[model samples]
Target: MNVAVIGGGGREHALARKLAQSDRIETVYAIPGNDGMRDVAEVVPEIGETDFEKIAALCTSKQVAWVVVGPEAPLSEGIADYLEGRGIKVFGPRKEEAKIESSKAFTKDIMEKYDIPTARYKAFTDYDAAYSYIESVGAPIVLKKDGLAAGKGVIVATDMDEALAGLDALMADSDAPIVIEEFLEGEEFSLMVLVNGDYTHSFEIIAQDHKRAFDNDEGPNTGGMGAYAPVRHIPESVRQEAVDQIVGPMARAMVSEGLDYFGVLYLGAIVTDKGVKTIEFNARFGDPEAQILLSLMEDDLVDVLEKVDRKEAFTLTFSPRYQVGVMLASAGYPGSYDKGHTIDFEAVREKSFVSGLKQENEGWVTAGGRVLLVTGEGETIESAIDSAYHNVDQVKFNEGEVFIRRDIGRHALK
Candidate 1:
């Protein structure tokens, strides 16, 4: 079967790479793909990520059997609805179900309704009320822009000053509401599950995502700096508890709510001394996590999804090796910094699932914030981290130092 992965980001690149490895798959295409995917996918550069009309037309013309939506934005924008409307099968949820990620308040509400454990939060469209709530609750609270911010809209305020500023910044826009939550302290790990609700079938794997832009968990949050799997710090019991207590309840909630979900569900949860609690939910595969975990999958991604669609009993397999990935971002990413650096991705493409590049003069240059990913495998988390960083340093970028958190997997060492 011919498959097309929509969206041109690291997640899409990783999806394209894995699908290309499938023997059951005849062809793989990446819609508006980047240079790193060139080895594996036919890059359809003319189509935009959300260009539904052209995507359906291209799918029809290309005889694309399945369209995999890689990023959340296109899913939130209803690409699945359009493609499915055109009689093309899609491996993603619809727009209404995509509210799982598109709106934080929506998820919070669902969690509340289902008695799912999560941080206590209040959604506010009124700036004064939000500011007052922060002042009343005190420091070390999480203030999130209720809408999508490319994973950067969160402000973990350590004090009243920062809290107010964060609220002001988020509420500066008219329609952007804010959600302030009581901070829950714990080590965070995310589990990605292919969920087709009806309580039918699901497959889950856990990964630890380093969100802080700088080392030692400092600096503001970006989409994610790096990731490794299976996470070593969080206990297997706690992770299982998350699946039974959190993941299960949420899936049942979707069914009861009359939402037919068929796609990836990223359950971002934290292991607290009290118990496992949800941090957030994403509608599709995560970028750095996808690059790492998918590389470890022993089964073809196409084959697994197909079995899930058929409601067949199947076990998703993973290599014994632990996989790690470190992101190389433009020097000033998650804020503002550099771009247009001439980079030769040839050296790292094989070991990486990269994005944020454009070909010019037969050379590549940084086009977005998070540029590339280098993945490495090992029997231990420490060796995996070592392997990933070692390969990342060899990437050919004709520019000054790039930003990377040196302490990505150090928690495992601790």
Candidate 2:
């Protein structure tokens, strides 16, 4: 089978790499792919997500059997709908369904309507009205832009003053509308589901991500610093409940609304004493997270996507082992940063547990602002983290600095 992956980022690179390993796959193509992906797949320069018509034409011309979208922007713009309309098999939610991620207000409204557990929120287009609401809602508030802002829109204000200030930044300064929500306190975890309308299959839970740019979770939000899979913090039972109550029902709700959601459903969840409530919903896969999550998946990714597109019942399996990834980024990331710098990963050493187990260096290259993802796999979260950081220490880049959360799997360790 020939596959075409859309988008040019570490997530797409990870997807392209995974697809290339499939025995059923004949050729893999990436539109505007980064330098790192050139090794695993043929990089096409002319085609991009914005050129939907040209991309569709290329899919037809190349005899591409499946199209996988890796980013939210194109999916929110309805690339999947366009491809499926042409009788092409594409993995992603339709535009109408994608509004769940494209518009924060829309997602909050849906959650309220369906009684899906989530933070209390109020949408505002007027600054005064928003500020008044924040004053009433009190301190430790959460502010979010109605539209996507490349994973940097949401702000957790530590006090009433900060909340008011955030409202000004999002509503007064920015062109997009704002959503002021009541901040909920708890441990956060990411849950992703592969869905075909009402049918859904869940993957292993992971808890590795640096939302803030600075260490110790202080500073502005970022796209993501790093991520890992088989999160130890979330118990298996709790993870399953989240899928059953949140992800499954949400997909079914979209289906009921005449939107056939066929792709990845990323749920940013908060585990509280009141059960799990959704922090946000992403129509596509999470970055860095996909890098580590997919690395540990034992099942064939291509087959899983095909089954979802066909709306057929299929069982997916995951390795019992845990996976961790540390992202090496340019000095200034999720902000103004340098690019085109040379990177080196040849010094990284790989470790293993089982006898006869051999390790492989996937090679290193500059692909995005966040240069590379160093991943490690092991039987336990502690072992996985140890291996991942060991490899991360060996990588070198010119004028580059990396930041990662120290408590990636702290909950699991407990």
Candidate 3:
């Protein structure tokens, strides 16, 4: 079977790599794929991910059996619905179901209606009204844009001045409503579940993502700095509680709300002293999180997604070894930075996933904020982390300094 994977990031690259491993799949094509994916999947550099007409034509021409979407933007824009309307098989949620990730206000309303555990939040359209709400709530607040902000739209402020400035910064250039939420203090973890509009569908192994750009969780938030699987910080009891009180309820609630959600549901939650509460929800597998999570999977990824598409019975299995993925970024990332730096892929020792590299006359150059993700697996978390960073240290970006967090998986190791 020939499958076409959408988007051209680390997540999409990881998905393409995993799906290509399936013996059931004969070919895999990546739309606008990066330079590294040429090794495993055929690269189609002409069509854009959001080019619905072009994508449909490609599927028809290639006799593509299944179309797997990797990014959230195309899903929220109703690409799956468009393709399915033309009788094309897609493994993603419809537009209405994608509201769970597209609109923060909509997600908060759903949580409130279903009595799910979450933080106190208020949506505002007027600047004065939003400022008044912030004053009432005091410092250490979270300001989020109502629509998609690429994961950096959220601003965590420490004081009223910073809060107001953050809100102003978000409101300065856009008219979209902003959601002011009370900050939840706890350890954060990522729980990604596969579903076919069924509340009883099982979830994959729990993983944790480090969103902050630098080590010790002290820096601006980027797409993702690093990630690891089988998070030990989240106890078994808390994990079960999250599945019961959070993931299960949300899945059923989507059905009740008349939304057929059929894809990966990512639950970004925090284990507070009081209990487990949701921090945010993503409509698909996370970037660096997908890197380590998919690395540990023992089951064929294409078969799993196909089963979800067919609503057939299939279970997800994982290796017991701990997996760690550390991201290598261009200097001054999560901020303004330079690109087109030459990168040495030959120095890399183990499996490494490329994100922002394109072939140039000289060599592969850094083309995005996050350059690559080097992953390693071992019997112990400490050994995995050690191996991951050791391989990361081998790669070099000649034009500028490459920054990486040395403390990835440290919290779990401790």
Each model's TM-score?
A: 0.97, 0.91, 0.97
| Candidate ranking (lDDT, best to worst) | 3, 1, 2
Model 3 misplaced stretches (Cα beyond 4 Å): none
TM-score of 1: 0.97
| Residue pairs with backbone atoms closer than 3 Å in model 2 (clashes) | 232-412, 233-412
Off by over 4 Å in 1: 200-204, 398-401
Shift of residue 262 alpha carbon in model 3, Å: 1.0
Off by over 4 Å in 2: 204-207, 347-368, 399-407
| lDDT (Cα, tens digit) per residue for candidate 2, span 1-414 | 799999878788878888999999989998867655676889886777668999899889999999999888898898988998998888888888889899999888878888888998888888888878887779898999888787888889998778877887787667777888888998788877888778888875555566776656777887886676777656788898788789887877777667777789898998888998999999988877787777677778888887776777766676778887766666666667654455566564222111001113543434345666677767888998787877776666544344445544444565
What does candidate 1 score in Cα RMSD to the true structure? 1.4
**lDDT of model 1 at position 83:** 93
